[model samples]
Target chain A: MNKRDIALIIIILIIAVLSYCIMNISSDKDGDMVLVTVDGKSYGTYKLHEDREFEIQNEYGYNIISIHDGEVCIKDADCPDKYCVKQGKISKNNESIICLPHKLVIETVRTMDDGGAGDIDSVAK
Target chain B: MSKHVAKLGIFIALAMIFSYIEVLIPFSFGIPGVKLGIANIVVVTGLYILKPQEVFVISVLRILLMGFLFGNMLTLVYSLAGGILSFVVMLVFKKITLFSIIGVSAAGGVFHNFGQILMAAFILHNEKIMYYFPVLLVAGVITGILIGFLSDNIIKALKHYN
Candidate 1:
């Protein structure tokens, strides 16, 4: 490896570090709700504080999501990869579990009000 | 001309074998989309021995054949995006002539992940998938370095044949 090679490696490392720091900074806010989207359309939004199991069945497949004690996880899924279930739990804002095969995304969000009117209102509109 | 074609065929076979080896290893870090990218060794070495277009052809053929045999259509799409982007970036880096083969291969690795993530985010219509970028970036650089090192040695050993 020459000087340029070392420089290129350092640049890539710096970019990775910067992105990691940015993700952490943006996700510092704790989320109180989980938003599920199928094929970019909102399926439902559930309160993180509630312990419940929600099953989503669509043309692509099915996934069972469980929220317990402010944490959200995919309890089960029929997607071939099972990557969403393997992703474990997430509670931080912007953190998410993605099921690519089904085009499903479950992400945490911070609602603007105590009643989560902001998310509902946006969804309604 | 026949000699060149024969050499390209050999590289393609070598790349396919590497892909097969990668599949058999079960080398998953559990992050999804992360792999050793061992087949890239052939791509990096090809950059030195073959024309840019020839290397591109080999890369595409390998992805298509391997994708059909071991992966699905979605994987084929991902591999095409990654492989094409990687080849372009590697070509540019190699053209500059300032960096060694290692740097060129490293750039290829990094861009390959970038392309795949971009495609995933677009297809999923969820920008949140960008969260995987940092981890993928680090993984790309590490694998790129290893592949680059191997390619450097291979190029040196094959200097007489070239």
Candidate 2:
């Protein structure tokens, strides 16, 4: 490795640090709702405190989502990778568990009345 | 020309073997889109021995064949995006001549992750996927450096063949 290679490594590390900090800071607020999207469309929005299980079956595949104690996770999935299930649970605003093979996304979102500024009003609209 | 074609075939086969080996290892970091990228060893080595276009072809062919044999359609899309993006970035860095093979490979590694994440965001229609970027970035650099180091030594040993 030469001087330029060292510099390149340093630059990449800096970018990683900056992005991590930004993502953490922006997601400081706890989410109050879980928004599920399938194939770029809204599947459903459930309150985080509800403690429920949601089953999603579609053309792509199947996934079972469970929300409990204000944290959301994919309890089960038929996708090959299972990365979403492995992602564990997310409680912070904007946190997500994505099933890429099924084109499914389960995101933690803050509702408008919950003091999350500038968020869309509802998934229904 | 025939000799070059024959060499390209060998490199492509080498890359595919690397891909197969990677699949056999069951390597996982729990996070999606993170891997050792073992196949990159061949592509990085090709940068010094073959034309940029030839290296690109080998990389593309490797992704396609691996996807068909072991992966699905969705994986094929993700691999194509990451493979193409990294190849372009590596070619540009190599042309600059300021960085060594390790640096070029490192850049390729980081861009490969970035490209895959970007594609994920687009397909999922949510920018929240960007949250995975930082972890993937670090993983990319580390794996890229390892692959680059291996490529550097391979290039050195192959110098005698010229």
Candidate 3:
């Protein structure tokens, strides 16, 4: 409605679009489980079968990570805010999920082959 | 003396009603503990209508009452952190930002989440949990927009309603 409004709108719109590109993203085939290795440890694994759900806990609380229909996500969490759980689902297009509180991320990448969307690696099952 | 008591009663009632609304809105994002926190609108209203100390008193009372009614003692920590942080953030925004009430309210939403998360990490002693910062920040961005957008429209309408 005014100049300030327009500026804020522009900033928000940019952020929204930039962020949209990161949602519903999936990873390449890493067998039945896509292991996101952060630092020296395996942060967690995404079980690629009919969109499974799991939880991983760090210092903060339990993070409910859900993978469904070939996508992965943080489904529920014990963290105070639960923002990661609220992020909805993510797929290959988005390719990764990150929760700041958990210092965790679930990303998609083929350890063997690159099949286009919907190609489920037999080993990844 | 009786009139003062009546005002307090009305304020408490309004807060309870708003808290109920906060729990009922259906915006589940498939993540645990995610909510729009709409009930905060009442606290924001208190901030504007009552003195800061009065607002503090009301906030403590509301959180305690709501916790007793619907939440556990553990959960009260997060609520208290969120409420107090929101007040601080809103107070700062009010001083410097030209944003409308909606914007101020949205900032409060983000602050509330931030405070809650900070407390969680502190209590748990897990600095790694801070990684959720970006994700929550993103959520805060979205929820802030949502609260701000709604409050903006409401603020515009409040003039005529009052």
Candidate 4:
């Protein structure tokens, strides 16, 4: 490869590293709440410390969300690939379990009153 | 003209096989949207051996066929987005002539992940999807470099055999 090509690759990698660090830094907040959404609309907010199982039915299918012992995860999902279920448990701020086909999102947030901190900011499923 | 079509068909078939092999292998790096992109080898090789039109046809056909065989509607959309973006980026890099085969393929890999994430963001209407960008970026570079190195060698072998 020429100098320019090498430079381009290096620049991309540097940006990647920087962005990763920034994302991690922002996600480090001590989260105490879980927010759920379907099709870009808010479903409800649940306390992370509570233990419960709830199903969200939408146009695509259903996702069974489980909140247990201060963490939340997809207990099961009817969507193909079971990617959301495979996401395991999430308790940290900005951590999310997404089911793209069902347009479902579950994220952990520090506060439920911020009105913006956990408003389905990202889809990482 | 028939001969050209036949050649494209063969290339597309080969690409499909690569795609199938990837499916059979349980190769997940624990990150969404990251892949080895083995099928990309065919597209990268075609960039040098086939005309631009032929390259596009082969790549798109391969993606469509693969989706039909092993993927759902969502998978098809993501693949189409990634494939088209990667192809376009590779073409631009090839035209630049400053990059070697490997460099071009690297660009293709990076852009492929970018296109998929962009599509995800649009569909979900969540900018948070971009949070996965950096991780996908690194995965793209690693896979792109691997695919580029393999394509470079494969092309050399084809030239020798020819």
Runs in model 4 deviating more than 4 A are A112-125
Give each candidate's fraction of reference contacts reproduced: 0.83, 0.87, 0.08, 0.62
Query: Order the candidates by DockQ, highest first — what do you get?
Result: 2, 1, 4, 3
Provide C-alpha RMSD values for all models, in order.
2.5, 1.9, 8.0, 3.0
Task: Tell me, by TM-score, which candidate is best.
Answer: 2
lDDT of 2 at A69: 86
Top candidate on DockQ is 2
Cα lDDT of model 2 by residue, A49-109, tens digit:
9899879999888999998888999999988878889889999877888899999988887
Write the residue-wise lDDT of candidate 3 on A1-125 in tens digits. Answer: 34564465456556545544444243322334455533325665656665666666555567766667666677677755566666665554224454544555555544434554445443233
lDDT of 4 by residue, B104-148 (tens): 988899999999989887878777778889988888988898998
Scored by lDDT, model 2 comes in at 0.88
Model 1 alpha-carbon drift over 4 Å, by segment:
A113-125, B160-162
lDDT per residue for candidate 4 within A32-115, as digits (tens), equals 888887877778988999899998887799889999999999999898778888879999887888888888878887664453
- Model 4, TM vs. native: 0.91
Q: Which of the predicted structures, 1 or 2, would earn the higher lDDT when compared with the native? A: 1
Chain A TM-score (model 2): 0.89
Residue A28's lDDT in candidate 1: 76
Tens-place lDDT per residue, model 3, B1-162, is 787667667777777777877777656655455577766666666555556676667777888899999876668887899889988887776667676665666667667877987976665443334444545555665676676666566555756854
iRMSD for each candidate structure, in the order shown: 0.9, 0.9, 6.7, 1.6
Every candidate's DockQ is 0.79, 0.83, 0.10, 0.62
- Model 1's TM-score against the true structure: 0.92
